[model samples]
Target: MCAKKMTYRDALKEAISEAMRNDSRVFLMGEDVARYGGTYAVTKGLAKEFGEDRIRDTPLSESAFTGAGIGAALGGMRPIVEIMTVNFSLLALDQIINNAATIRHMSGGQFRIPLVIRMATGSGKQLAAQHSHSLEVMYAHVPGLKVICPATVEDARGMLQAALDDPNPVIMFEHVSLYNMSDEIEDNTKVDLKSAKIRRSGEDITLITFGGSLHKTLQAAEELAAQNIDCEVLDLRSLRPLDHDAILASIRKTHRAVVIEEGWRSFGVAAEIMALVMEKAFYELDAPIARACGVEVPIPYAKHLEDASVPQVPDIVAKVQEVLNSDV
Candidate 1:
């Protein structure tokens, strides 16, 4: 609603800018985000408005700067730390998985790290193994950290505000390929940080997903509908504290589910979702749940192979049909 034609990228940027305007304590820091306006230009002009002091740019040391941002959050300021990619987030894993994740619990629940770390994830630019990875499940596995994946324009707009307002540390994962996507936004475009949104409603089957793969699921839902198979789409925006109620409700209605995730098939978020559904919605399910996930391999550099590695529209459509057609 802030921009004439809203993009997922702009929504996130505007949310941060609005937060900065409303709260002096909200600041930003990352590599090239200040001067270069970020690798994807998410903060193209923020440095000029907030000035370099607040919109700080740090050295390429992901570990040092990300840790510094965490320290800054502990001291006072609400810092939004931008890691260039999920691939690079591994460099700061110690800081994020250890200190930032454990501080609140280690300090007898006295300290709250109100830090927001944003990073681009998933493979779409033919960036090989080192440049592309979806490790959101790893972050979500931590007890004290909150993980969010905003798969829509409105969520991309609103989640940052909710994340900033939270007293605990939050990591937001944005897929690189989704930055250019444009979507409709209403004036009442805000959303809660902790709940899931049912993007499309149906009773035949549930297409469960978040982040980059959510759009693929939605497209599959439409394709399935053409064949008279109605699919329910659940966007698990908050990956960590998944809104199980939304998922179970849909599965309870559809009596079936097909999870879609862009990450590798092994130990992925999709696997977790399927497990949760089986445990909580077992009696409600009329058929076995399924998942359409990335092939179990390092993403290849070739265009076709890269495309083959991740979940695609065709794969989701096929999986939904298979789930719907399967016997319990």
Candidate 2:
């Protein structure tokens, strides 16, 4: 097998670099992404190689820069706009929801948004409420945009290329907690952005998750394995265009499901999965689906509270058992 010694960060960087090299229309813009190398440093050294013309940096005005990216994209340039965090992306709500999202359909297919927005999301570093959010539900709720949250080393490296290649606008969420988690990465060969992958196989239950919560779901699966409960783990790599086939197939096998989302408990992506499960696999389900999600309260500044605000392994474990025991 072809392989390389790389972290998820390197994988993500290589993906962006390859896209930049292959497409003249593809360029990056955001606050500190050019010289300072991005808030998460994933775009470091890119500005030096591509120069400021392509790897352009902008002021801290999230709404203005986001709108600029939209304009540039509509004008035939593919712009990868980076927001430091999803919390700040809220500041660009009008530009994203009203403009970038609806431009294609609203224009009767005369216009298309070939734009990509990259932003860091979720809580783990005690950054508190202002800096943390799992906004995939918010973005996915929009009809005109595609949302992707890559939780693996290969995806972190490959999804950028796939997102940039797509004809429509896409929003990618890179969870802050996943930046440093090292897994031996195999470069570029096995990556695909259009489908979900079953990370671990089992028949007792299916644990569905994405983004930072994926790690916790896997941990919970491992813990369940010790009890002779085989839990399958399904990574919903692409959120908006969810791999419904993969989800339903896993549900068909397990007949029990638990969806773990790092976002709030109310009206989150987990709720979407529950709806889909009922619609697609209702007859196959042996029990009601369960969701393990973050509390509805704002993320707290304390380290312990911040950790508790989001779903944890124990939360996943309990939810899985609840589904296994409950009858729909």
Off by over 4 Å in 2: none
lDDT of 1 at 125: 94
How would you encode candidate 1's per-residue C-alpha lDDT over 83-168 as one tens digit per residue?
Answer: 99998999999999899999999999888899999999999899999888788998988888999999888888788888989988
By how many angstroms RMSD does model 1 differ from the true structure? 1.4
- Check candidate 1 and list the clashing pairs: none
lDDT of 2 at 21: 93
Candidate 1: segments with Cα more than 4 A from true spot: 1-4
CA lDDT for candidate 1: 0.88
- For model 1, what is the error of residue 14's alpha carbon versus the real structure, in angstroms, after optimal superposition? 0.6
* C-alpha RMSD in Å of predicted model 2 compared with the true structure: 1.4
lDDT of 2 by residue, 1-328 (tens): 6777777777778888998898899899998988899888899999999999999889889999999999998899999999999999999999999999999998999999999999999999888889997888999999899999999887887787788888799999999988887777665655556699899999899999998988888989999999899999999998888889999999999899999998998998889999999988899999988888899999999998998888898888888877777876
What is the alpha-carbon lDDT for the whole of candidate 2? 0.89
